[model samples]
Target: MGTTRTIKNKHAANGSGIKGSKASKNGPVNDGVIKAKKNAGTRAPIPGSGVKGRPNLADILKKRKKRVYSEKELGLPQLNMVTPVGVQKPRGKKKGKVFVDDRESMATILAIVQAEKDGQIESKMIKARQMEEIREARRAEADKKESERKAKLEETKDSLRKKRKRPRAGGKTQDDDVNGFEAVKALAAEGTKAAKPKKKRVSFAAD
Candidate 1:
């Protein structure tokens, strides 16, 4: 039992020793040491040369200055420059001159004139229609008056014909009096003749 306890204590001390130690504090593992050896062989730095600073290309371009140009050389007007050529004098009369020259401008003027003409034509047509209406109204009134006058004349003519057909007492005809006073006179004569008794009575007066 004493030998067995000594063996068990030695085994527990070995397991704890490995568990408590840090991996990075100890030397590198076999795989990591092999990778470091391969990279050092292929990527070795040059002797006496460290990392270089970036180039200052902007300072090198600033040393070369751009060329300047004069106003006369560039065909531009200068402040002190004078007019060497004299001004041209005017010529001929200004009468009968046409200001607008292009076809487009002349077409615009013609359009305005045409519009005015069309407006005038429309106005004239409207006036003509109005005048026609007035004439028609007058003709209607004249026709109405003519009809009225004709009716009055016909009425007067009909009255005159009726008066002529009727017989007047002052201008009576023989036929009209035959049935009036003439008939009465004939009856009175017949009565008087019948009343006289043969007139022989006159001879008896001698007896």
Candidate 2:
């Protein structure tokens, strides 16, 4: 009979089995240094700290300083202009009177103006004559109506005279008719008698 020796594993001999290096005692590594968390517990306040009681607005405005910021400080981009400055625009053409050298056209225009004037004068004269004729006709009509009225009045007067001169029926008797006739005869006889001759008075005065 032979005796055998047993070999023990090396990994089992170590304390841990992880593959990487041992972890650090502190937290994970950061690219920059970490700041410690501030204490939230109450502490004595600073004299210049916390929300300050608002100061007088007028005093603050009066004492405030004005700061002018440059374009570089404000981070504005630079601008480039391409066009030229101060170029004057073209001037417009001015208006001027033009004279014509055509004498025949000018004479024709003058003749046309004179013809218009003559037409206006003729129209005015014709209107005046027509108005005069209308007035004369009205006057003639008035005169004719007046003459007719006078003739009618004269006819009425003649009619009234005839009515007055006409004898009334049953108003005259036969005796009245006879008396009127005898009176007319006596007047005719007196008018027909001749005047007597003057008597001679010379014989009685001689004795």
Best by TM-score: 1
Q: Where does the lowest 10-residue lDDT sum fall in candidate 2? A: 1-10
- Kindly report which residue stretches of model 2 are placed more than 4 angstroms away from their true locations once superposed: 1-94, 98-102, 167-207
Error of model 2, residue 51, in angstroms = 68
Residue lDDT tens for model 1, 56-132: 32122112111112212354443445655644334474745678889999999999999999999999999999999
Query: Cα deviation of 98 in candidate 1 (Å)?
Result: 2.6
lDDT of 2 by residue, 51-166 (tens): 33323421221122111122123543234345455453334744555555699888988899999999999999999999999999999999999999999999998885553333
Worst 10 residues of 1 by lDDT: 59-68
For candidate 1, the TM-score is 0.35
